[model samples]
Target chain A: MTATQALVVPRGTGKTHHRPSRTWPMTVLGIIFLAIMVFPIYWMINSSLQANSGAATTAWFPVDLTFSGYEAAIQQQGGNLVTSLIIAIGTVVLTLVIATPAAYGLARFKMKGMTAFVFVLLITQMIPTIVIANALYALFNDWGLLNSYLGLILADSAAQIPFAIILMRAFMASLPQTLVEAALVDGANNFRAFVSIVVPISKNAIITAALFTFLGAWGDFLFALTLTSTPQVRPITLGIYNYLGANVQQWGPVMATAVIASVPAGLLLILAQKYIAAGALGGAIK
Target chain B: MTSLHVEAAEARSRPRPGGGRSRSRNRTLHYLTRWLFVAPAIIFVLVFFGYPIVQNVVMSLQDYTTATFYTGIAPWVGFENYAKVFGNPLFWTTVINTLLFTVGSIVFQFGIGMALALFFKRHFPLSGFLRSLLLLPWLLPLIASAAVWKWILDQGSGALNQFLGLFGVQPVPWLVSPSLALIAVIGVNIWLGIPFNTTILYSGLQAVPGELYEAAALDGAVGWKAFWHITWPSIRSVVSVVIVLGVVYTLKVVDIILGLTGGGPANSTQTLATWAYQNSFVQFLFGQGAAISNVLIAVSLVFSLAYLYMTRKEVDE
Candidate 1:
């Protein structure tokens, strides 16, 4: 009972031992983890700003922050920054229009074999682009759709649909069925109920689905590389490829382009950090 | 009193089975409306999604090579393309390389994610801020991350090399080395994947009641013992889901490798994904590429089915 006495001495009753606080250790570890996560991005920004004076060399910080790489990348890469922006924006629009309804369907409907259908949707998630790369290239050639905006949209859409469905389905499934039932009782038809009741309630899911699909389409490269040849339709990803020739890889401009293109996703991450974290965790756990 | 009782019985049976059948007919109409909502998506998939997948499989068996082109005949090469696949040492090499990448990514990614989750379970200052920041890598487009890493790992003058030089280590040829390239790319992937795994495992951990740990501690369980006995059981379902998903994801990953090395250094870092592309597109061996992809598809299907089965069983139990 001597050991018990030592444990009980804190409260002089039956209380456990009083331990010292662990605040500082946790804080230090948390800060270290943050640094590890943020350093690469910090390095990317710093390197992107460095001038050509030390361009051939490695320096962690910029000798002088210059916008010349950005200027050069924009001026020389393709038609203009406008073209790349337009293509990205267009991709986002196309992806949303197609993905939204599909997600709604998968989420709300208790269709026969819907679970199997979802499994199929998930299965198609990331079919190696290489598998159909040649045949697709050939098919596009035959149809004269190769390197066209329509072709890029179609290819990107194919990949986006499955992910959109999964995210949207989960979102829809979480909505209270009572509200939808109320709309039904009020004599609102299925379509009208979905539009006025179910959809408005599930706006957050819709937005998240849009954000996920848009980002995926925006950053796509392989299909962009294989599908499009002309600069007229090239997104920033493939546009950056021009800077990377067979021999000399232009690190300065490549980094600059990467920094610019990454801004939207970066900002979106911070803005929607909570939802993204939730979605990321929820999707993984489920 | 008898008349009142008869009236009550009629009222109770007013909505009969016949009426219920009519209600179902109305529901059938509602169900048709639901189909209408989902029909466009189905049509889109059938045309662009289903058609191409089926076409790709069919085309994989044909003699679609240039040799058959001049004759204008694609002769039946049933299983010959598959034979060519098994016969090639390169194909087997790609499979091995892909497996290594997948296994390495899963272990490190899950390990780091689990560690972060455990750490975050404790109430700490700026834990929320740290969690938010970690989402950057996973949220960013793979292209952007790959591009940034490409710059960071540049041999001649990259930040990674500069950082290494501080310790007097020579600059390593990250992308150029066939031996190091897959691992190098995998390292970046792990970085991208850790945040995702952390987010997932963290959420799963949060759902675990504090009472379980309190009870375990009362019984003298502490640290790893507590975790194995209490924490593991609580999060087992989520962990199983994550592992199966990790496998499927790592199997399908192509963009990172494509951006990093393009499966170069004599195809040393070539994965099944990249190999499928190379054979089908670059070599104009569409049949071979399709076969390789089918192999990937088959493997992925098996994992999905297994995960579904396990998850269903867990739910039932």
Candidate 2:
């Protein structure tokens, strides 16, 4: 109830606030809503454990759970999961390295065309991934980047960098200008000051950016589908897509693969809940 | 924010007693270093976004194909790609489907999201926990969600059919049938979209002062009337942002459709995005794909421009 009270009570009001007794019923209804909304995810896990019936005879629950689906999924998609992990981590590193400085520059700099640059970043988010994929396919083909990890890492980072910059810039913009200036006055250069001062203070925003970048890269399907043709560089997303392509007599392995693919998102949602919430608003409203 | 900008500017302009030439050189160095901060990102945007947009335009006008990759001989067709895209009978179906999918997803997603937002705004036990848990659908990979929903909506022994059978209702072919495929896909999209919409709108609702409701109630402006006069006007800007962003995101949705129905039962759910994918990757007709995606781009550009205009207006006000 303390959490509920914290949510219900507005700031700066010290009065004794009492929730009506009826509000408890609202909690039940809220749970039902969340249950419905999240049932697909539950079903994903449930069906993954059911025996390979090869038909729509999955029970409502995994009453007789089996590990064959997981064994099959790991045999099939373990490498792709690793590929996705490496790409996602690489995207996070590249995105933060490129976007963090740019975010700080745009936030603090009084340079000309900064607004125009920000405008362009905003516009980039609106462009469909297919258009980028179409052109990147031809470009990657010409540059010999097709079916390469670097190719996918670069493409996925491209999609995420703009949003990362925007998210971090909103946070960095609020940093007191004097914080960096004091370091500059102490004879540290801009880069050094940013490294020492801005980066540490903006840790929350940076992590939020990194988390989202990782998620974006992990969940990327079009770039993987378009840029990589062979199984060598396939991410688990495309792995699942291909699993669906086969006759799919048994969905056990498919659902197991889904559960595997969803671990990062689900884990982050639980562990980094505050950062994710901040990002959910920051990425959109800012 | 403006005050901080002015303060930073004043700090920068404060005089230092130095030789003019060295000062100019130092200033130049300073600007160069500033440019270095954003240069990589600018280059990335150029190569990834700018070049692709330009290349897509150029490709859309040519006879580019898988053969073009091999021969490097994409003859200039001079709008023939667009002509082909426009002339194809499936073109109109895609256009309508795209419109319907985007608009339908937005409408239901926003509506249900707003309702949930209002519901959660009330003080209730475990409300915060439930609301946060609601983000699971949106957080999961679209393909994963699509896979699960595909099973749940499977006609034979899918959970939905099984559940409906309890009421003696016949199995509904959610994804297989052409007539219902689009609606099913949109329903899944709405399910995916609700968490985001609800989270944003709930935050917006939270920002509305509680005092307004307390004051409105004294004048009998409670419940729906209070919401209309107080809540609606307050969250109008957030609503617009949500709607515009939703449209832009929903406009180019490819993963869900491809995973669920593959835009099929004879192309019933083939939006411009999927069509573009089919052309470029599936059929290896890069030019036609570029042309179709360019159309998608133009449609998204309209909404993006509207968003920019709205934000600018908000700033001015």
Candidate 3:
């Protein structure tokens, strides 16, 4: 999105050789905006570091740093963090396996019911997740999938797969048809041509989908709350939730746990910025 | 080589749009391959989305409870569940809460989001970086967001109160007060939603051809006049999309509320979504929960239909 930003930024901004007079005010105001938006995050980190440890009289800064919160947070929430990672990885693999081919087909083929299929995918997004969970709880119970990693992975992927398909399909739709058509001339079948030709071209889209799926599964609370009854398959999100349930005064550890869970998202923001931006806009526009 | 040539020739002949047995068989095979790709997704949708909807409706009509899980019997009660829901006084509170929460969140979120988008539209140094960083709140697992906000809004130790103390302002019992809980939830939700609205609205702002601004400037229509005439008109579709989606997404908000207040201080923060979860999971009254959710679904369906209608031209285009 910053790449797109360079086009619209004023001539006096980054494009210019020297600083412009008016740019400073806008920059100052912009920083103020960032500060307000990011202060809660700062507070979370600050309070986590303070020895006061959830005291009402927390200093503006840590003043005195402490690792006790981090120690407690890891000691308790570490297993759930691993659970989140496993579930997130499983969702990425499963979503890609299912959605990639479907996205390619929807983008490239003129299959019957294509419009209806797309429409269904869009409408499904509108359905409140509670409605799905209500049914899934019963279904998972009967299938003995409750509190299992596979169940949560499949359930979380349900939310990711449709959006992934739509996102990848949009990218795939713009690809030149001749890429795959040329491969067909070699004795490769449709699936083979797709695997060898189409898949390589859609790497960015697949990565975007994978990142989003990982995030969605890792951040998931609804399905994990509904489907998982025991601690065996609990996610980090739920660990923070259980911390809140205790309703303790020592929020230092709770904040630390939340900060731990948010690390990947922060890293992804700085590293995979473009794909993150694309996913943000593309998924919503559709 | 000859065989490849014949296959290419056959492919060229595909435009005939005719029906012969062999040609029809080939058409069936092609369709079959395409459907194969979509089949798994379709099956998942049917089992997950499709079945849930039908099951919810069916469950709503019966006396389904925790006992029914073991007995495999949920006697039909017809519209009794609906009647009871309509008669229940908490039902109305939930309806009002849902509307207030949805409308309040969307208004501020859209309003501030618009301001932020317009602010960042004028490209200054680091504007782009700051704008992207705004998404931090949104990208965090909402549960994590809720945990932080729950502490921040705490009457005593919360950061908000502590900050206010410097100004000699008394602590506000944000989540614990009945009148203030819903408002506080809306505030947190607005914070969560602002980044999304900004990103989309900013994208919409970008799509406005810059030439129009230049052209409008020549007409001496500057500032608000230029925006009202050119910018608003150009991005009206995006505004509609953002507003409608904000409404839809806000209507289904559960995790944040559950995390923050648990619909307490006399169930003040209970929206239809949280109420549905309370009935179904917490209280184990599946039928009543399903009934409440059906109403929520109806509400969502209205906005979703409006959204689809608004975006129809884009879809067709």
Candidate 4:
């Protein structure tokens, strides 16, 4: 048994190494590629901590680090940050509410043109948001929703639902049919069965959808910037633009605000890393 | 699994409706409930998302601007805006630039993504963490990601130049040179896009059965040969989907350019999206801007229709 166990371990190792020990070449290439990708984030973090002049100095690392940039950005954008948070959170809540039930219906019932509904959603996703940005601004202004949190929420919420529906539906359809049938035979009404049986089984997928909606809401820039004029309702992303329009570039604070704004989405990505990876790959390719 | 949990809970709470009898009132209630479940989403989209699209079409025809303020139709331009759009040299330049950027970014992005996906398939230790970390560029909001890139690519004292100096190469003006600026922006876009493609392709690759590769190896296929013979066939559907979606997405990209170059250093980097934005927002040339957007929409629609057709063909086949 000892000999057999020892044999199994090397066999596993041998099979993997069959590809070759070209580690030097592969690692060098990978490091170059990853450096190109990672440098920007590194730059952002580095510059965020440096003073204004220090940022323009030829140092990749912060020679003199400070949190004044953060302090200033937060002081300036404290209200805006709260507004962005509200809009993002609101978009997620609204999307989940609308999409979850529709997804359930699409999954369980043999609705007419269900495939068509999915197609419609794919089409909508294809349309560039900028194409409709001006028109939306005009319409929102007409309806007295321009520069309002509710307007941005409504726009983003609309964009998010189709995806949420499809994601939930796919997860639902993959579920065993007999479970729903069993619930029916157990005398639960359709609504009650869907609520209890379908919803619970699709929890992971729903959570994945919720996470995606949150990312979309948080990352949204064109719509948020275009629709809102006032600092009161503008998201953190739009606030970054104000830095560009200032008398000077203010690279330190800009980087600081950028890092600050990215934290929520970055944290979301790191925390939901598994679900997000699964969702990104599965949601599209599968 | 929320669905499964819901099913189990339903099993305990309600009395079983026997299979044999199809009750009329129950079926009616089911449909009504389903409709109710779906209505709010549909209404929300129709009011906000759907209505704006119709308004866009109407706005494109009017010669409204900041001055006119939509106080009636300025004139019934009637494709005059569109004709002028086509006639504009800058419009054509933007269109060409947009196409090039999209094509360039997609090719490199997909190539690197595919390579990474194939590498990840071997399942080395800690590969999962690497894959997750790889999502950082895609995960960061575009503004932040682009801002970070802007700082790194800044001409005077950015990270890229500073790093290059260590190797004794002269510092290059990444975002200041017209020829290099577009490519620089493209490079950042590729970074943001590759992790996403890798994840998607990796998942697609995983769904391909290991048995085929085993069989191919048994028949003496190795490395590239085995992958070509087995993996490619299995992932054809997914690859097609990715290509179509990638084209549509890359075409619509504006934020990265806006944040990084502002379509600047002589407008060499202007794409249709940014051009549309600059026209309406900066110049306040609403009519021409609307026309520019209409053209973009038309181009994108053609791409989407092709995608839809391919998807249909895949389903049919």
TM-score of chain B of each: 0.87, 0.93, 0.93, 0.87
lDDT of 4 by residue, A1-286 (tens): 1111111121112124434455445545555656666667877888888777334564567887889888888988888788888998999999998999888776666554444555566577788878778677777766888888889998888778887876777667667889988988999977788789888888898888888888888878898878887766888887876665443356777888989888976787767765775566544521
DockQ of each: 0.30, 0.49, 0.49, 0.34
TM-score of chain B for predicted candidate 2: 0.93
All models, RMSD in angstroms: 9.5, 4.7, 5.4, 7.5
**What are the Cα lDDT values of the candidates?**
0.70, 0.86, 0.84, 0.74
Candidate 2 to native Cα RMSD, angstroms: 4.7
TM-score of 4: 0.87
lDDT of 3 by residue, B90-205 (tens): 99999999989999999999999999999888887787788889988878999989998998898987889988888999999999999999999999999999998998888888
Candidate 1 structure quality by residue, lDDT tens digits, A193-273: 878887777777777766766677777777887777676777787766555434335566677777787787887876886
- Which candidate wins on lDDT? 2
Scoring only the A-chain of each prediction against the true A-chain gives TM-scores of 0.83, 0.93, 0.93, 0.87
Residue-by-residue lDDT tens digits, candidate 1, B165-256: 88999989998898889889889888988987886677677767678989989999999999999999988877877778888888878777
Error of 3 at A225 (Å): 0.8
Whole-model alpha-carbon lDDT for candidate 3 = 0.84
The residue-by-residue lDDT of candidate 3 on A1-286, one tens digit each, is: 2212222322222333225688888889999988998888888888788766666577788889898899999999999999999999999999999999989888887543665676677778888999999988888888889999999998998988888887888778778998888888877888998898889988998998888888888999999999988989999999999988876789889989989999989999999998888777764732
Model 2, position A2, has a per-residue lDDT of 14
